[model samples]
Target: MSEEEEVELLLTELFDWYGYDFTNYSRASLKRRIIRLCSLDKFTSYVELRYRIRTDTDYLKRFVEEITVNVTEMFRDPLFYRTLRTDVIKNLAAKPFIRIWHAGCSTGEEVYSMAILLQEANLLQKSLLYATDLNPSVLEKARKGLFPLSQMKQYSENYIASGGAQDFSKYYTAHYGQAKFDTMLAEKMIFSMHNLVSDRSFNEFDLILCRNVLIYFDKNLQERVLKLFDDSVGPLGYLALGAKETLKFSSIQSKFKQLNKEKIWQKIR
Candidate 1:
């Protein structure tokens, strides 16, 4: 069989046996990741990996991480965070309680970024942050709140560029080649494994962020997930996308108003 056909069948079996729904992910990108996985693990073909996942639960867990892992950093795209701080946070401060969901939040950098933002604004006490990803391994890393200390210099610059009011270094302590973020940032944050493709929205949120995530999905999955996000956000709530992602191609495009210079959108009740 051709490689394309093999991957299609692999995706099907992956869903049927493992309950993972990656069939609608962008075909080229998904194929690249899977092929890379096969190369890394010395599998002759995609079917070999699929067969292993079918028989070994541990292999399945690793496969999930291989495909879903994404690059992330604290206060990534600093300008976006700047816009959020100046434009979005002020509005959220008026709410008695705020719920924010960092959907597809790989490794929880942005989740911690949000916590620090709220903490500075004095809004952290009234806020609940849900940071979720499809892979449990990434969520575990997020829960630990440990990152490479070598990256602290760059992250600190990003924090300052993102309108951070205090010393970014104060948020984490460096030791043993790692930086462990303060516990207070994790206090109101909940980390969980949530598959955007197969899972339903769990709660209504004042803001939903799925940054740099949907670009991996096909149009159908993107629309499906956007609708799920739309339903999950309350009236007059906000949605933030990656710089390259937009509501222009979404099913609920007309319902949002782009308020800031960034990608944040408000659901026009």
Candidate 2:
């Protein structure tokens, strides 16, 4: 079989056996990630990797962790949060209550970032955050709200750059090299398993933040996910994407207006 055919079979087997669909992911990036995984696992061939993934639960878990790609930090791309603080939050204040969904919220750093923004804006008491990810392992980490204490300095810098008004250190307590965030910040958050691929939209949201997640998806999957976000957001609600992502070329592009030239879109009535 050709190399292309072999990779195709591998992806098909993964979906059929594991129900985790990478069939719609960006082909080049997915291929690179899988190849890296194969090297890390010391597999001589794709077939060997497939066999291990099929029969070995531990191997499969590692495969999922590697492919799901959890490279994220608290208040990542600080300017994005600054935009949210100044523009999105200001516009949302007229509403009596708000619901924000952080889709594909890996490890909950961005989730906590949004929570902190809301808290600083005095909107936390009136807001509910829905943090969802397909990977259960990352979701568990997010639920714990613990991060390395050494990373707090960087996170604190991000917070300040993102328009944080108070001492960022006040939000967490460090112990044993880990910083556990204030439970009060998470009080209004609901973290759960949500697959953008197979899951149906559950509620209308005032704002949906799905940053840095769609770059992995192919055009078709990106359009489908964008449509889901469009349908799930209430009239005039806000939608934010990664700096490199946009609503252009998507079927729902006409449904939203560019709130920020840097990939933030607001639902148009």
Candidate 3:
């Protein structure tokens, strides 16, 4: 069999062994990540990689971290956060309290970004933010609320563009070339490991931000995940996707009204 066919069998075995269900992920990207992992670990072939995965649970956990998406930063798209603050937050403010889910919240930058926005809006005190990712390693870093000091400059710029003009430095203290954010924002967030491919939604949310995450999945998986998001959102709840993702062709497309065709969407039906 070809290497591609071996990958297919390996993915199935991976699911059966670890319950990750990577079978429906976009084949090209998943293969790339797997190949990258194999190369880094000095595996000569997928057969060797598969052997290690089947026998080494501890190594599998580490392997899972490498394959999953974790590239994220605070206020990733300034305009998206700008739109949330200007249009979405006010609608949420009318509520007695709010629940926001930051799905795929790698390293918690954008999750804290949302928390900071809510604090500025005087809504953080009344909000519960759920931040979830499939990787626990990143989640641990996120829970600590520290980011590299080198990143603070760019993050500050993003904060300003997202309509936060305050001294962004005031939010975190610098030590040993790293910036640790205050616990005030962390207090309102609950971080957990959640896999979109294999896990079901656990709660109804007023707003769900799974931004930039769906682009990695195949259309079938994206459709399933979109429907899952649809079911997880409460009536009139909002969803903010990546600039490149949309509900336009999904089965749940008509059920949601366009808040912003490329970014924000509202469940109307």
Worst 10 residues of 2 by lDDT: 255-264
Clashing pairs in 1: none
- Which pairs clash in the backbone of model 2? none
**Local distance difference test values of all predictions, in order:** 0.91, 0.88, 0.90
TM-score of each model, paired residue for residue: 0.97, 0.95, 0.97
lDDT of 3 by residue, 1-269 (tens): 89899999998898888787888888999889988998889999888998999999888988888888788899988988898998899899999889999999988999999999999999999999999998888899999998999999999999999899789988999989999998999999999989898789899999999988899999999998998899899989998898789888789989988765348988899
Tens digits of per-residue lDDT for model 2 on 1-269?
87677889988898899787888988888888888988887888988888888999888877877888787899899888888888898899889999999999889999999888888888999999999988888999999999999999999999999888799999999989999999999898999989898788999999998988999998889988988998899989999998789887778888888865557788886
**Clash totals for all models, in order?**
0, 0, 0
In terms of lDDT, the poorest run of 10 residues in model 3 is: 256-265
Candidate scoring better on lDDT of 1 and 2: 1
> What local lDDT score does residue 21 receive in model 1, on the 0 to 100 scale?
91
How many backbone clashes are present in model 1?
0
- Best TM-score among the predictions, by candidate number: 1
* TM-score of structure candidate 2: 0.95
Off by over 4 Å in 2: none
- Please identify which of the two predictions, 2 or 3, would achieve the higher lDDT against the true structure: 3
Global CA lDDT of candidate 3, please?
0.90
